[model samples]
Target: MLGATLVSAFSLAGCGEEKAGAQLQGPPPAPVRAAVLERKDVPLRYEYVGQTEGSRSVEVRARVQGLLLKRTYREGAFVREGDVLFLIDPEKYRASSAQTGGELAALRAKLEQTRLEHNRISDLFAKGVVSAKERDDAFAAYDSAKANVAAAEAKMQSEQLDLGYTQVRAPISGITSQEVRSEGSLITTDSAGSLLTTITQLDPLYVNFAIPGTESMQVRRQAQEGKVVVPAEGYSVRLKLADGSVFEQAGRLTFEDRYVDPSTGSIRARAEISNVKAQVLPGEFVRVLLDGALMKDAIVIPERAVLFSQNGPMVYVIGEGDVAELRPVTLGQGVTGGLVVESGLEAGQRIVVDGIMKVRPGGAVSVIPEPEAGGEGKPVAAGKEQSAGNGGVN
Candidate 1:
């Protein structure tokens, strides 16, 4: 019986030692890194999908009805205002102009003869040599001749205008599109049918975009709360091409719609972009980033620290005694290094930047403070920004 008791005691001792070894290791308390939040100005920049458009799009059409004799400008060529684009057969217009000219000349000669007769009759009436009816008849004939001459001159002006229209000229300087009416085809002045070609002015292009009214209102609210500072002038814009490349030239905000769209609840906005090289084409889709407003005294944190849950965007912050605590934060948008915390965060707090998988709410953790980023954790002295607001490069 004594031997049996000793064997049972030995077994219990061995199991206790195994449990103690496991407790000693304990997975090293889940090593994780963190960043300290500092209050500094963050640029309240925004990005929206946009489209490029030419500053001016003009339709090149014949102003008068005529047979198109030849196309003067090549298709897809650059043209200047008043440059002849097509030559309508000028024969008919020229002949009509000549006819008017000849009629005007004949009327002018007749007018001269009537003036002489009227003057002679006046002289005869003064001397009492002609009857009153005879003097009246001369005066009436002279007036008739004058009226005929005036009518002929008006006809001549109309004919001259028609002659000028025979040569179809560009109404605006721009890049011309393909010819819609080829040579030898009859073109007309009818508004519905008079599309000969199109010319688009792309030198100063426009980038059109829309922002939902709710977003705009929130920006204004933040500015009112002393958290945002809007520039006196306006925002500067940049364009991102389809291939994820940025356009070389910069742009400025020039137009804003007066009211929000009732259907889409979006406010229309436009940016005037420099296209001196004609690199941007009309109707091209792009992404527009606008900068100028400053989000002041903001808390920014790394993205990995943020965890998405059904409740909303939340993060695990290192609290007192190095314990991880769950924090629900509202975020505006993303920035260069991380996201700006709209609410539910403060300065000088530690958050997990990497090894988030090691973190859990209400649990003790090993502290690993990460090196402060240039702008994310490091506080900027007054006017000592690495650069201006988000309006410039990061």
Candidate 2:
């Protein structure tokens, strides 16, 4: 009898311990945040590598041939229109202009004397005191003197123009480049030696990029099929710097090549942006973002909710009974905050957005709807009492 009582007491203690353990492990369900899918129009954006250039690049050249006396503007400095850039020796041009002016004055004095002679001859002829031949000769001399004065006047004007060209001035307002020919160099008016420097306008910068021909054709097909809607006004451009910072100013499309490059298989495109502060430099590389295309009636989800497997991308769909079901999804281009769902998902379905790691197919999950900004947080539905299974997407 003592042995029986001792065995019974030990069995009761074991049962009580088992019951306690079961109680401690109450109905465990994976806690996760989910969002109801909705179909809405979302904007599409395309990204590509690009490079910047000046809106206007001009070569500063010398118009007259002479020795470069000195450079007036500093190299790599911002210069205004009509600002003096260099000085050429003007002594020869000045002397020629003075000599032409003296010749013009002498011819004008001769014209006056000839006119007086012609007038005196006309009066004598009217009084029959001189021959008609003499009067005709006087008139011819007066006309010849006047022609000489006119020719000398034109020569003087030409010399003056050459004198003015000695002082080289900027043709446009822009940032200047380094001097190609320094001071004391013999400058020439020919094409080979005329280039003095370069000037680039920086207020409105051009960003050049290329789009693959295949991608462009695909977009056109999609547009015709009613899957994509392009903006009528055209795309708005934004830039991302190498440091991953967005540019402050926005831009618009300026040019698009009609034909694809045979070598690169891409069509060149360009955009113009206002860079009043001169923040963007020419020849700098950047990332181009083309905005203004709309995806029609598309389903989107958070990037964190996406899971990858050997098959493709998958997502956890909260089905009936608040059970997490793994569904394979086809993804399209990414939108502002999430990715567009191409297929295998629909509107009015809930998917796991947060705590995806703890979810398993056919396992109960406590569904917490993502809280709106500045709103109270609460669980959308309490999961059924079930064990948290260990199975997950591979």
Candidate 3:
């Protein structure tokens, strides 16, 4: 009897322990981070690797043959239009000009003397004081003097032009590269070489990038349909630098190529941006952010909230009472901040952003206080129960 009572008591204790375990609540809810959706204008942007180019570039070369005497401007300096960049040996040109002027003056004196003699001879011939041959000789002498004077004047003008060419000036206002040919370097007009320096305009810079041919057509169609919203002629564009910082100034789409490249099957597009401060430079790689097309009531979520599954891309949504529901979302193109969801999600929905691994479907949860809209801190949700409910949990 004693053995039977002990066995019964032990069995009852085991049952009680099992019942207590079943009634006990699960561990405290696992904390999770979440984000609330708000309806606003979300910009549709396509990013491509692009390079900055100067809108205008000019090569400063010597036009006349001479030895480079001095570099007036320092290399890698900003220059204005008509700024003297280099000084060729102007001594030779000056001498040539002076010689031409002297010759012209001498010819003028000769012409004046010959004209006086011709007048005298013509009067004498008219009065029968001298023969016609003398008058004809005087006329020929005057004409020859006049021709010599004209030739001397032409030579003088040529020399003056050559003297002007001795001073190499910047054709456009821009920043110049280092001198290619230093002082004392002999240069010629037909040397088949580049100039002393290169100047590039940086105030309004150009960005050149190539887009797939298919995308180019789509952009054009959208623009024609009035679906893509663009600014006025001087609208602003944003640029992403190589270091991932947003450029201060905005740019505008300047031009697009009409024909696609047969080899690459891409069309080139250019955007112009104001670099008044000279912050942006040529040949630097940048990412362009165009903010023309606005999607009305588009669904967006933090990129980290999205998860890839065998079924498709999905996100954990926090429904009423902070219950996390795994939702399959159709994704569109990705933008700067997040991915665009085409379907299966709506605006004003809350989605899990952090601590996503600790929750199951229909699990009781607690939502912690979050920062205000567009603020820093993210909203966090904590699950209260571990029980896997009726809904499938994957």
TM-scores, in order shown?
0.79, 0.85, 0.75
Q: Encode model 3's per-residue lDDT on 1-394: one tens digit a residue.
A: 9999999999999999998997786655556765666555567777777899999998787889889998988777899999998888999999989988988999999999999999999989999999878888999999999999999988999999999999988999999998888889898886564378899999899999888998768766766776555445533468899889999988788887889999999988899999988898999999887676665555667677788889998888878866778899998777656887778877667777666677676665555655546754443333211222232223
User: lDDT (CA) for every model shown?
Assistant: 0.83, 0.87, 0.79
Worst 10 residues of 3 by lDDT: 383-392
Candidate number with greatest TM-score:
2
| Alpha-carbon runs more than 4 Å astray in model 2 | 2-27, 113-143, 370-394
Off by over 4 Å in 3: 1-40, 113-148, 218-235, 317-324, 335-337, 347-355, 362-394
Model 1 stretches astray by more than 4 angstroms? 1-33, 309-312, 319-326, 358-394
**Residue range 92-160, candidate 2, lDDT tens digits:** 899999988888999999999999999999999999999999999999999999999989988998899
Q: On residues 191-241, what C-alpha lDDT tens digit does candidate 1 reach at each position? A: 865788999999799999999999888888888887789888889899999
Number of colliding residue pairs in model 1:
0
